[model samples]
Each structure stands twice: as structure tokens, then as C-alpha cells.
Target: MSETAPTPAPAPKRRSTFLRDLVIIVVAALLASFLVKAYLVRSFWIPSGSMENTLMINDRVLVNELVPKVAPLRRGDVIVFRDPGGWLGPGMGDDLVKRVIGLPGDTVACCDARGRLSVNGHAVDEPYVVLSRGSDRVVRDDFSVTVPAGALWVMGDNRYDSADSRVHGTVPEADVVGRAFVITWPAGRWSVLSRYGDEWDGVPAP
Candidate 1:
């Protein structure tokens, strides 16, 4: 009788080294992103209509947290800051965003001879001002005040609906959080926020 050939031994099972490496890579990436957000930049979401026509409700903004450490805030810069007058109310949190209209030691007023806002005796043409709801009306209120030293005068674009400097007075410089640089969400609306304008350029320094 012929002897049967011995069956070959089954091959040893292999380890899933690829999957293990992939998991490690993903974890590292997430950690790096968190560090950057906490120290360099942060994402903020708009919760009200205060900055309408410029930043709408639910809009996503990118703030450069490192900016305050590197440079001083300038006129016309949109900034996120802590509430100064307790206007946000208790348990309502503290952060709010508004446009910088007057710097320390500068005089700011509303409703010039042409119904425009003025800064440091110069009339400012604000094309971005949002009109009141259901009417072709602009905020024509008369107000005049000098921004105190180490403070800022800010306001919202939607003047009729916003409760800002007009109601709370000036904000201390230390209250400013950071400068808004970009709108990143709602893919179709992505754009860098610009701080330059004819009026902004002509604003006199304190």
C-alpha cells in the first residue's frame, strides 16, 4: 500500500498592525488640534442679532486669540470681549462681540448734520449700518461722549436692535478678548473680515 502524503501545517495567523498604527495617528492629530485652538485661535458662534448685516445669528467666527498679545486693537476692528456693565445678566455668560467705533480719549457721537455718525470731529459714512426692521429708517439718535482713557466705545451694526455702548457706556481695554478674523462656517458665506475703510483710515489717534 502506498503511504499517504502528510498534510501541510496551516499558516500562522497575522496581526493587524496597520489598524493599530492608524488609531495612534488619529489620536495624535486630535491632540494637536486642541492645543492650537486653546492657545492660538478659537471658534465662536453668534447667538444674537446684535451684529446683523455683518454677522448673523448662528454664524461661526474664527477669533485670533494671539492678536492681543502681539498688537493693539485699532479703530473699526470687530472684537469679542467680556461684558462690562452686567448687561448680559446673571448666568447669561460674559462674552460678546461688537465693532470698535471710538478709542480711548476720542470723542464719538451720532447723527451729524447729515445724519451720520462722527468720531473725533470727523463725520463717518457708515454704509454697513443696518436699517430698522420693516422701515427704511436709520438710527438718527443724537449722542455725544468722549471715550475715557483705557476704555473703548463699541456698537453693533444693527443699531435699532442692539444693546451696546449706547446703553452700557464704555468698556475697559482689559475686557477685550480678541479680534475676529474670519467667518468659517456656512461654506457659501466664507470670507475674511476686513477692517479697512476710508473712515477707519482717517480716525485720529489719541
Candidate 2:
């Protein structure tokens, strides 16, 4: 009686190994991306022109959520955070991006003689403020406020159009989502987002 020819060796061992290895590679890649998104960095889409010139609408940005863990949040950090209040309409959205103008316990004011936002008595040179190209204007109405303990005063690069901390008040430090570190979309606009921290140097600590 002829046997069943060993049933074609029950499928090749090599084929099984190849499939298993492929699965492992795929799973490993998926896991790496998840970890990076969870702890290292996260990508966000700009929904408005609030950060115009510096960050335009639809520009995708990469925020380093790892920053607060690595270093203290400081002035000039371009950050994303949950809405402090009316800044975001009901059910419209929550996350907003702005440059930190005031740290906890710091005072933020607008348009010092040269019309730049000043933080804690230091007159910062704000070259990032963008006015419609031909306008060359930079004052966004005079206002002053002190950032309460454990809160941050944030503003957009496009001051006039942005509804930020100046509108809804300071965001709790805990509400900060991350520090935006790069603009990753629109090839022509791709560049590392820089913080004006150097200018904060020598500025008195709050």
C-alpha cells in the first residue's frame, strides 16, 4: 500500500518561518510608531491661520511631548494645549497652538514702546509677529495680565487673528499638550521651529 507521500511534508517549514518573520517585522514597526507617538512626539494639523507666517493653516507640525519631561517649560516655547475656556467654541475643538508669553506668576503685556509683547518687565523683540504683508502693523490692542500660579499665557504668531490666552485667559500648566518643535508639511515650509529662548536669557525668573 502506498503512503500519502508524507502529505507534502505538511507545508514547508521555510514558508512558515518566512511568514512568522514578516509578521514580527510588521508588528515591531507598528509598536515603534506607537511608542514614538505616545512618548517622544506627536503630529498635529493646523486648523487655522492663527499662527500664520510662522505656521499657516493646514501646516502639520511635530510636537515634542517629551520636552516638559526633559526640561522645564519656559517662555518662548511654541506650545499646544487644551482650550483654557471660550477660546475654543463649544464642541468645535480643544487643542490650540501658541507661543508661551508668560510663565507661572509672570506678567504679560502688549506693545511696549516698540510694540512687542513684553513678559515680566523684559521687552522681548518679537520678529515672529506677522501682519498682513503690506500692512506692516503690529499692535493688537493694549492689554495686560498676570499669569496665575500653575498657568501659562500663550499667544499666536498672528496676534490679531488668534484667540488665545489673551482671549480666554491662561491655560493651566497641566493643560499643555506639548512643545511644537518642527513644521513637517508643505515642503517649502519644512523647517525646525525655533524658540526665542535665547532672548529670554538674562530675563529675571518668576
Candidate 3:
């Protein structure tokens, strides 16, 4: 009888190895992402009209959480901070984003002679303001107050609708979370949120 051809050796078992490698890759990616989010940047969503016109409801923003940890916050920086006075209400959560108008030991006021806002004796022209219905007829008014030491004066772009420093007074620097760097959602609206340098150019440093 003809000798039967030797059967081919069984193929090496590779499925297990491939699965293990894949799992390792996935785990590594997750760890890397978590570290980045914790120390470099993070995402936040707008929940109310407190910062309207500049930041709309449901807007997704990217925050540089690591910046404040490395450097001190400055005037005119738009920041996200933990809510004080329990303004957000019980169980409503913390964190409110607003523009920095005044820093520690600085004066913050609203409605300059030209219906603009002012900081440290310098008038700030805000083109981002969105006036509320019927309120537009009554031109913006003026008020003056100094920011207490270790605190900040913040406000929403939509002054008529926002409940900010005008309502709650100054916020402490320790409460600040991070500066908003970008609006990352709604693809078509993606853009960097840069500070209005001119507004703060002449204002004295605190």
C-alpha cells in the first residue's frame, strides 16, 4: 500500500495571543486618556444662560485645567469655577463659567458713561453683550465696587440674563477651576476663545 502523506502539523495557536495584545492596547489607551484629562485638559458643558452670547446652552468647551495649577490666574481670563453661596442650589452641582473682569484688589464696575463696563478705572467695551427684551430701551447703568483680596469679579456676556458677580459678589481665586480655551462641539462652531487683549491692555495689574 502507498504510504500516506504525513499530515501537516497543526497551525500555531495565535488567536489567544492576538486577543491578549488587543486587550493590553485598549487598557493602555484608556489610562493615557485618563491621565491627560486629569492633568492637562478636560471637557465641560454649558448648563445655563449665565454665559450666553459668548457660550450658549449645551455648548461643549475644552478647559485647560492644568494652567491654574502651574500659573496664577489673571484678569480678563474666562474661567470655570466652583459655585459659592450655593447659587446653583442644592444637588444642582458646582462649577460656573464666567469672564474675569476684576482680580484681587481691583475695582469692578458696570455701565460706564457710554453704557460699557469698567475695571480698575478703565472702561471696557464689550461687543459680546446680548441685551434682554424691553431692557434694551433702558440703557445699561453704572455701578462701582472693588474686588476683595484673594477674590475675583466675574460676569456673563449676556448681562441682562446672567446672575454673576453683580448678584453674588466676588469669587475667590481658590474657587477657580480652569480657563476655557476652546469650544469643541457643534463642528461648525468650533473656535478658540481668546481673551480680548485690548479691553485689558490699559488696565493696571492687581
Say which candidate scores most in lDDT: 1
Best-to-worst order by lDDT is 1, 2, 3
Instruction: Return the TM-score for each candidate structure.
Output: 0.80, 0.83, 0.81
Model 1 ranges off by over 4 Å: 1-32, 133-138
1 or 3: which has the higher TM-score? 3
TM-score for predicted model 2 compared with the true structure: 0.83
lDDT of 1 by residue, 1-206 (tens): 99999986543322356667788999999988998898778888888999888898888999887766678888888899988767797776679999999998999977765667878888777767797656443464779899999899998888888898988999888987899999998787798887766668887765
Model 2 worst lDDT run, 10 consecutive residues: 131-140
Model 2 segments beyond 4 Å from truth?
1-22, 132-138
TM-score of 3: 0.81
The prediction achieving the highest TM-score against the true structure is: 2
User: Relative to the unseen true structure, what is the C-alpha lDDT of residue 189 in candidate 1, on a scale of 0 to 100?
Assistant: 75
Full-model lDDT, candidate 2: 0.82
- Which residue pairs in candidate 2 have backbone atoms (N, alpha carbon, C) closer than 3 angstroms, thus clashing? none
| Candidate 1 root-mean-square deviation in Å | 5.2
**Positional deviation of residue 152's Cα in model 1 after best superposition, in angstroms:** 0.5
Clashes of each: 0, 0, 0
Give the alpha carbon lDDT tens digit for every residue of 1-206 in model 3.
Answer: 89999987544557677888999999999999999898878899888887777888889999998657887676667899998775687766688899888888887766655566667777776667787575531125567888888788888887777788877888888887899989998787798986787767778764
